[model samples]
Target: MHFQFDDRLNSFRQEVRDFVAANLPAHIVNRQRHKSFAPDDLHTAEWQAILHKNGWSVPGWPLEYGGTGWSPLQQFVFNDECAAADAPVFPWGPRDMVGPIIYTFGSDYLKETFLPMIREGRHYWCQGFSEPGSGSDLASLRTTAVRQGDSYIVNGQKIWTSGAAVAKWGFFLVKTDTSGKPQQGISFLIIDMSTPGISVRPIQQMDGDDHLCEVFLDNVAVPVEHLVGEEGKGWTYAKDLLDHERTGSSYIFWNKRELAKAREIASSETIDGIAVIDSEPFRSRLARIEAQLTALEWSVLRMLADEQTPWHPSALASCLKVRGAQLQQSITDLQMQAMGRKSLRFIAPQQMADFPVSTLWPDYLVGKTSVALITRAATIYGGTLQIQRTIIAKMAFGV
Candidate 1:
């Protein structure tokens, strides 16, 4: 909760900063500066390998399973430092979302087989939670998996599956029983993406990227051993997973880093013979956003500390989720506004090196427009604003 760090924490932060500076690849830093969603598979694997070598791959996990074994404050400091250095975080599904589930509730076989692969970055994983009809109402999903001899026949479609096209595995929510309530009948399974009858259709975006996909499983055989925990217990496990995810969703570190970049871009670019940041109206907006972001960052520190706070963790997490997503959208809008007409003109990857070399826009503006458009959905993913409102109404207000 303190604004300034103590000696030990400050040293740890410096260590993380030095690691990022010395080890993070140049290509990854460039892609992140331009707001590319993530580094490509090769770069990510290389980065993860370096983290694994140093026992920094999964900071949130138990130490035995390749976690950093850092205190909560250390974890927060690490993320803050990484984002400050423009370093990419490890992929979520393998490191944050599912790895904990396996270590906490999975069989010995599951942990031995998958945790090592995830630690080594040998496979990419995706979530199969949402469907065409089921958006935030994931409990009402219609995808079904029938248990057979040694495997389960999975048949259904999942939309908005991030990284599904390239992910080698997926953790899915499926209707494994129909006689009971919808939430009670659900099960979680890790499906091999290479299985027969499994198909991925990339969802092209305005950003000239295909990070999302529609995954169809038509009678795809998933081994029963891949099921996590127990039958019909996935809803419970999913609740745990979502809690981990939404807690991380505050994204204060990311917002803080990106806000600093926005400040840089505004001060560097000029409009009508004046620096964009010199405008009073723009400063007013930036000032307000900066204040709110500072408050959000403090709230994150408070939650991470796990000390007694006036607000409950669940309610505070929902609050963070709401503000963080909104702040992301605001920052991107500011970036697009700072660039003005230059944001409108775009160039291909190859042309990026030479195009607009002598302009105020600079190369960073190349992907700013696409990032702005895509971030409009920031409030919708993970959990929508409506869902967070529902959670806060229940937990914070007890209405």
Candidate 2:
């Protein structure tokens, strides 16, 4: 398989880099560079608007749907350059996860109503799949949507919903029927977050951020027209979304950027007057991580190129998720090690602007500790490492 970028791709990469350099805001870049958490809703919307103005907002969608019509390779290059430039990670629920499903399977009315808002950044979306007891076992979700003529009354709770507090809309999986199997009774529904009886409460994290939320729906009424595809077909739609999400779980771009930061820290931070990176053991660990990252990147590229693979798509995605989650934790652990005691300083997100800066503790150290603390969940979320291993085993061995 060809690993090198051709002349056209190289040119495209430079073009993206130049655009980001010219137009990406300095303040946003600063926050993204030092902060491990995603940008707030305002910044996310603003960045999406900027990309929309440049006609680069949704590069992976069909050309007719405000997409750039770029090839998969081009999309990869765009994402890599944006991540390298410290671009705010756009909210995936709208742009990546649910948007494609809407365009691909939704009614023409649904498309007309939501697609434009999504592209223009006029609305933000959150996924409402995980319930109180149903996360990895998504088909067992207990949320119910009872049809009531023109609308459906949705009643249940969704936990670990990212950005629900600020999201304008949510795509939820609810049981429209229960007589059939757990997976067969589900239906996909789009609900307005501001709808009465819908309450969102943020769940505080060790990192001191409340990006994750619990959404409680108490007899929330959602228009019947908001349903995506057909009833009893939500499981099918959800699988499509989950596949996209699992592929992204590899977190290649984030890994590359954080690994570079780890290297920078190792170079500057000292151990008995010698740079941490200069030590043999630490250097070896860093080299190993870099090599693993290279392999991960190649695996993602192979998937993008649609190369033949012996493993099923599900198994392949599980393998990538397992390794990618491992690398995230390892890289962050190395960063914490390099920072040593300075990593102990805990600065809350709200205090970042007013906190006094020290020459001994530079701005680069702002989010190091927090990131390391939160990355502990890397393997747990997006399906646990154990679960991924089971999937791989089942697919590979039929056991």
Candidate 3:
């Protein structure tokens, strides 16, 4: 767990930086800078295609499955550098979440059908886990899937489904048998978004974007083959998928990049004729956040290096998620503070083109307000702050 830099790692980092600088389209980067959640579908696909061509699309997966066969440290460096370079955040549902579940537990037919599309950026995917009342208590999901010979007829609703509007497919959690325990009866099923009985309705957000959506399925027939692994074992696969990218729950790369942006804003922004960074109050706040960020990064690196911890792996992941969600809010808060009055000038996504660009309203300040607004839900989504703390208490301390 030593924090020393290795020459090999440093060189690898430089290599990734060079690749992104040479290959990443400037227009996409510009659009990404203004986006608070994720890049638009076109830019995301274009960027993913470029990465796939260079064999860097899925760096953490196994070599045979179109991965780079990179060690955990190498994967960490790759993500860190990419975030710093403002690479479009590729859809994680396809590459990180469902892709792994399919490859690891899915049948050969499933792998042949989905993995190539995911790696090549030919399809976009979304998770259908959280429903109206089941956001945090995922085990209580009531979506039902009844077997009908070769297919399962699914009928339910999923809320807060990110990117569902643009997604071509979705992996959902459904109750296959209510006779057993809620957790025991749950099953995982992949459904085509274009299915006859499926509908996606975008939910308007305070940020003026419809990145989140409500998905409804009425008698949506999903192929039996689409069920991942075995029946009534979906709860297990879902947990594995959640824990697959454990360190990602920390959001270290994103926090680091946003922190750097916060510093840039502070250096340029003025508070009563003094640069924000020069103010004692602002400097102290920035320093404290930097220290916390450093500690968080070290903790993630220790986990990547397989350093043992007293807590269970699930509890550790929950701990990281709690801290990372806080930092997301804090870093954005600092940016909003740095912008001061400028942050108050709200610009909807549709008005960006019409919005005038001037010294008073620079590109950097364009999405700061919107991003800050959306980040308020960081602690609520994935898992609520209260739920994560309860998890840590139950699993880590056995309270």
- What is each predicted model's overall lDDT from 0 to 1? 0.83, 0.88, 0.89
Candidate 1 stretches with Cα past 4 Å from truth are 347-361
Number of the predicted model whose lDDT against the real structure is largest: 3
Candidate 1 residue 43 C-alpha distance from true site, Å: 1.9
- How would the candidate models be sorted by lDDT, starting from the highest? 3, 2, 1
**Residues 1-399, model 1: lDDT tens digits:** 356678999988888988888988887777666545533565677788888888888888887887877998998888888778777766788888899899988999999989999988888899999999898888899999998999999999999999998899999999999898889999989999999999999898766667889999999999999999999999999888866775578778778877887888888888898898998888998999999998888877877777687765678778989999999999888887777677787554334434554565566566666667777878998889999999999988898
**Over 4 Å off, model 3:** none
Residue 312's C-alpha lDDT in candidate 2?
Answer: 82
Q: Candidate 2, after superposition: displacement of residue 192 in Å? A: 0.6
Instruction: Name the better of 1 and 3 by TM-score.
Output: 3
Tens-place lDDT digits, model 2, residues 1-399: 559889999999999999999999998887665565744677677888999999999888898999998988899999999988888877788888888999999999999999999998887788888888898788899999999999999989999988898888999999999998899999999999999999999999999888899999999999999999999999999889867775587989989988998998898899889999999989999999999999999999988888887888888889899999999899999998898888888888777755566778777778888888888888987788988899999997787
Which one wins on TM-score?
3
Weakest lDDT window of 10 consecutive positions for candidate 2: 31-40
